[model samples]
Target: MDLPRYPYHQSLEQRSGQPQRRPVVIVGAGPVGLTLALDLAKRDVPVVVIDDSDRIGEGSRAVCWAKRTLEVFDHLGVGEAVAREGVRWQRGRVFHGEREAYAFDLLPEAHHKMPAMVNLQQDQVEARLVRAVQLEPRIELRGRHELIGLEQDADGVTLNVRTPDGLFDMRADWVVGCDGARSPTRTLLGLGFAGQVFEDRFLIADVRLAPGVRPRGLDPATPERWFWFDPPFHRGQSVLLHAQADGLWRIDFQLGRDANVDAERDPERIRARVAAMLGSDGFELVWSSIYQFCCRRAERLRVGSVLLAGDAAHQVSPFGARGANSGVQDADNLGWKLAAVVKGEGDDVLLDSYEFERIEAADDNIGHSTRATDFISPKSALSLRLRKAALDLAAHTDFAKPLVNSGRLSLPTAHVDSPLSTADAEVWTSGPGPGCPAPDAPLDEGGWLSEQFGRGFVLLAFGWPVQAPGLRVITLPAEGVAATRYGARPGSVHLIRPDAVVAARWHRFDAADVAAALARAHGRPQ
Candidate 1:
């Protein structure tokens, strides 16, 4: 499929030779930046999104969009389209050599609005996000408008941008760097990534099978993630296979540190690898590349009025699908808080919470990614022997299955330690707690519980008539999935943040208590 190219036009600031200050200026018109722009626009906050490139990137860089990311995308107005167009799968099979070790399911439970994971090419994902941004009136997307330099003061940030017409200056109350790992915005802010780089490399090939051709021993119609450790075709190495939309299959072959990078990138060599595994050559190589991944994050997520997000803030190995998934979550975490601060409903304290929560999340992802990398590519012979033993025992022993880490897979991390969460004053046996993403349940009325939350605080009152001034209060019967998931009983109340995180919950409703918890959620001292 041909990638859509967004037209680049000279900005008004460049045409009029006067700087315009925007509420939020997002650098990089990729998925993260565009998602943030749409999110902020939904909050009635105007945003200017600029990118150095006018076209979607070439390769299928990120293929796995997790459930939490899909939920975030749903609010941005592209969730339905993404889910429909992407391949949905939950089952994954892990293989040790030629034998199957075990299988796992990502979403064992049902009734959620979105699936466990969706595999859509990165380019297609960006195309959908770009179209969404275009439809939103409050978001101004300017392609080929690059940020040359930026200076931040107490009040706002001044950015020097280079456009097709000429150089221009623009100001923003806040600047977000969604540009990739080598982010220019991050460079300008003098931030550095502090983490470890894995000593192994991987070769990725996106292939489209010819007519009537299918992978050996696998149903092409069924989508499943396949990970192999020391496979027969690729001995002493790990391989990952993911089925994507539009007949595209993403395959990653582990290449040790001393492998020839250029030679491995050859189309014929990649084709040979695919043929060796599938026992068929009736496939066209769509894209191929070699990369060495790292589990690293920026020194700081925020510096004054400028903030870093997406790959600019953190990076992880592709093993767990953490990179793009976590980046989109960053947008979800920041959108409402930044909008509140920009609209004068919140202060610096509220915005700073984004830094704390996302940094914590980043560290968690980095740690997991690091562990996956180490297990996949053990540096020493002793570690390799241990990994082999673990895999050998995993097939028959339940105890050793946990030791086999073929990328733990991506799952949303709850900010249970966040300072924004109010301590639970009551005990609950079930349901999400403070600083946890609100679990979706099939409402007795019809739609899912998440469909009712908006871009503001939501108060879920169970079996009681409760009203909180200026808050969306949802009254529900204390039964069914909603009650079961929330552990809701008579007079139980839960305060949900704009991002659908549980800020606080109580056994009974009290307007004053709800108000105080809401204040704490907004970074105001109760």
Candidate 2:
């Protein structure tokens, strides 16, 4: 599919020969950068996004958008459009050789606003986000503008940008680096990632089956994630198949460390490998790439006045579909806090919480990625045997099924230990606690519970008439899934952050207690 291109234009700062200081200057125009731009714009904070390129990124890089990510997009006003054009699927099948080990459903129940996941190309997502950014008057997107030098002091950062027109200087109270894994901004900051880089490589091919044609034994039209371990066609290696929007299908083949990278990336070689597995050669190749993944993270997400986000902060293997999803979530986590600080409504320490919470999340994602990599590419002979045995048993015994790890799959990690969370003063059962992503439910008021979130601090009061200054007070009925999902009772109250994380809850409403919790959530000293 053809993608829309954006042309580079000289900025006002460059034309006027003046270094204008912006509220927030974001580097990179990928999905994460654009998401942050849109988020800050929504919060009434002006932001400028700079990228070295004029087009959406190349290839179908991250195709899976998780439920939580979709909810975030909903707040940004593109969730429905993305869901409508993307292929939605909940069921995934894991196969051990020729036998099906297990079939799992991501969302077994209904009534949620979004689906389990959506498969859409990265270029398409970026295009939509760019459109949104163009419409927002508060946002300025400068294409072909690249950050070459950055210096941060107590108050703000000075950036030396290189553009097609010429080199220019700009200033920002805050700078965010949303560049990819090999981030130039991170390099300018003299920081590096520290972690494991697996030698094993993988081949990615986007193949489009001929119209009205399907593989002999495989169903290309079915929107399900299929993972194969030691399949007959691709002996000893693993293969992952995912159906994407349009007639395109994404295929990943494990290529061992010693495999020829150049030969494997050849179009004919990719076709042969895909044909061997699909039992057809009539498909057209859209895009192909060979890559070796690593599980690594920066030492710190924030360094003085500059912040690193998305792949610049952390990077994981794509098996779990965690790369882009986690990056978008990082934007969701940082947008509100940064906006508040820029507006002087929040303490500088609140920005520290962004570092703390996102580092915790990155570490969690890195751990999962490391484990999945080790399992998928066992180095030791004993480890290989053990993995094979586990897969073998998983096909027969229910007990061993839990041992199978085809990438744990991306899920939002609760910031239970975050410093921002207000500890529960009362016991709770079967409900989201502090720092947990708020669960969505169909409200009796005809809209979903999540629709009321993302604007600001939300106080859900059940069977109580409570009011707090500057807080959006939502009185929910004490019935249906909204009440049940929250474990609500009469007089129960829950405080949700702008990012839709539960900050604190109370068994009964008390004005003083609510004030204290709100202050704590805002990162004020208790």
Candidate 3:
């Protein structure tokens, strides 16, 4: 059997031309996959993404975008557009009852470049990412195409894809399985997806709120705010309200364990619940559905040439807004490593680091999200009493505020053993650390940390004048704007990776130390 030609143009011209396969073949066109595609494309690595979905749709699922996700978009150059469409949320009010409510402001100082969180529908986010993916010349997006099977060798992977016409085999240096939780690719590898499934089911409805009773502090025209109500439908259920970009409000109601799933599906039952909560608000129904929440993690993220990401790798409860955010982080983490290995800048063993770093991050996210869900869901009688009691205490004490907000919403990475952080340098102590994103700091030139560091490796030197010669370094003044912007001490230097992660930091160290750190990260001593 003659293999297809190696050039994309020739392969397309011959119709059976097997252009030299891309460095990576990504399955699934969701935000995770698209994000990986865009990042790899930006690094000039050829990539092909296959998705069964032909078009993007406006759905009310996974609507919260955290600051870390926003930072990622900023790196991709679509942050402004996302911000334009998204509603900035600085504070959240949690209600124990109608009168005993407590409000916490998420980003009070407003000094950071990105807001703490943004409320935007998941569909809108996908649309933006898809557009970005399409614009990249190195990315070939095959919609309506499905991955039927794939086999991996010591050097590369051969994928079997099914299209409307027939099945075709393509080879690639690497394969990424961003396919959702029930991932066929994962099944093909016989990898186990281990986690728990919550028995409670929740109904999500997207509807237009009547003009008279629009929720306070929410823009009727823009979907920007979230509201959580307790004792929904009865004394035990909970409800969540989210504003959508299309003037529709997304309402999630918890149906007790004994409630009939069929009855909840009825349009009348859904509308009745909406009316009961909003009270004669004349809400017009737009969309309604019910879904069970699951908390699971793949036994392994990488199986030879295949890699799992997004919901395929781990499914977390939605309470802490970790689902999409963590998925995107997985995409970001894997994208650069794939680009490096495929381009021959690094060894294939670098691929193993993706699982090493992201799997732990995913597990951490699951643990945090699970705790948040348990606190909010209150499955047992003791759990319910503890939740109510905690809420009561939070209403009055400042000590409880941090406890409630601790894991509810934050993107903190564990980089202790990551290859990215091989140095014993105390960089993580000053601010951002390796395996973790660099903190957003103001720049002297009226920009943020991202603007100054802009794509690729950056070395911030505080005092010494030694240079890597070939590496990019931005010098900071000893006591001026750069110092204020980066919170740089008099003799410290911060080394940032291509993806804007702090690879290492030195506080008044020898030039040899900086060279050693860079050598470890780039595989060559400066």
Candidate 4:
């Protein structure tokens, strides 16, 4: 359901004489902004999201969502909706010289409930998030509102916004910028976004399927599959196909270096490319455009009272499906911390960890995307030959198949050095370590690790246990499911945070030590 727009005067009056500003103001209504708003709102934190666009655009930009991002969406209560509309691909086939060269199936069915990746257009994703945001009364989504400037002090941030009518100011305890790569908020903070830009350009077109011509390698009736054609446009071109729920397909092709922008605008050229790629499969072009890829990182993610998330902070080439996934992860990392500080559960120091953790994740993503891009589109003769040789060898070697398909190419985050992780503890066979998510395993009472613990502290007690005040501890039998899953041995304990990351572990299960660790993890002194 679309939200009714508020009159400019009414909005201004509501801001006047407000005793308490929201804990955070998120600028930009993209998936990152909306996801952060919903996450914080669920935690009972007041949040407002502002976007310059009055409505979601029709452009089909981001097309793939990673498995980790699907988990985050599930936590936000929109995963099922996404899954219903998304196209799931469990297998990928690589072709060389117009013949199938390599094929790899993703993780076996036992490893995941869904496929490793899904094909869902960014516009549809925005729609789902918008619906979820509207259902949350605490989350205010203001359209046609732009953040012009902001000033922050020790306590809060006062922002100047320009709406369709005029200018006004709103205050928040913290400000988050999710406003994309050319972020005005990032500019105001004097942050530098530095990186390398690939000079190659690509044209993207979203089109409807014609009567007989259907996308190759995917069933026309199934909308959950994607097709990638290498040497896409010609010898040096690439084409990506994403099937949409509405019987539409998105096609992306690399433009020849000699091609001009006018070449992209020519519908005949696009149709010819699509026809050639589809090979007798017909399609009608709906929309088309061209873009250049870049691999860049923000020098700093935080500047005083303002913080950056999503594309606003960093950008990666659209390879390995990193940009949208990384941005959503950034929102997940920052949302809870913002809520904790606002509710007086933690100090500002807790906010600093956002930069520490997300910056590292961004760096990992950039490296992964850069390598993937280089592998797919090698720039030099030597690199091209190397990639082809590696692919050729993989085609002949059974042992090398997994390496090519692991998509482990998208690096997972480990919080080994995060200040939030508790160190200097005896190694435990049963509990979670710092910077690690609690492993999913069965409980004694026919439950799961996520089912046993709510979005708060979970203390796992194995073997003989001692009582601790203000903590939720679940005792398990010796060598039981919990012990096996969390690597917990007898007489050990684990402290897990709401985000499911293990805060600390102890082998002895000493009440005093456990108390101190929990206090520190929760940002309180014992």
Clashing pairs in 2: none
**Candidate 1 wrong stretches, greater than 4 Å:** none
Model 3: residues >4 Å from true position, as ranges? 1-14, 17-20, 216-229, 232-234, 402-407, 424-429, 463-466, 479-487, 523-526
Structure candidate 1, residue pairs in collision? none
Candidate 1, 1-526: lDDT as tens digits: 5666777997788778888888899999888998898989999999999999898988889999999899889887788899999999999999999798889999999899999999999999999988888888998888899899999887799999988887889999899999999899999999888899887889998999888877757687778999999999999999999999999888899999999988887778888999998788988888888999889999899999999999999999988899999999899899999988888887678768999999999999998998989999998999999999999999999999989898988887899988889988777888899999898887776988777764789999999778789898888888777888888898999999888899999998888998888888888866
Q: Tell how far residue 65 is off in model 3, in angstroms.
A: 1.0
> Could you give candidate 3's per-residue lDDT for residues 425-520 as a string of tens digits?
453334555556776666666777666553567888776555765578776666664565555787778788765677777777566777777666
Clashes of each: 0, 0, 6, 12
- For each candidate, give its TM-score against the true structure: 0.98, 0.98, 0.91, 0.88
> Candidate 3 at 440: error in angstroms?
0.7
Ranking of all predicted structures according to lDDT, beginning with the best and ending with the worst: 2, 1, 4, 3
Against the true structure, candidate 2 reaches a TM-score of 0.98
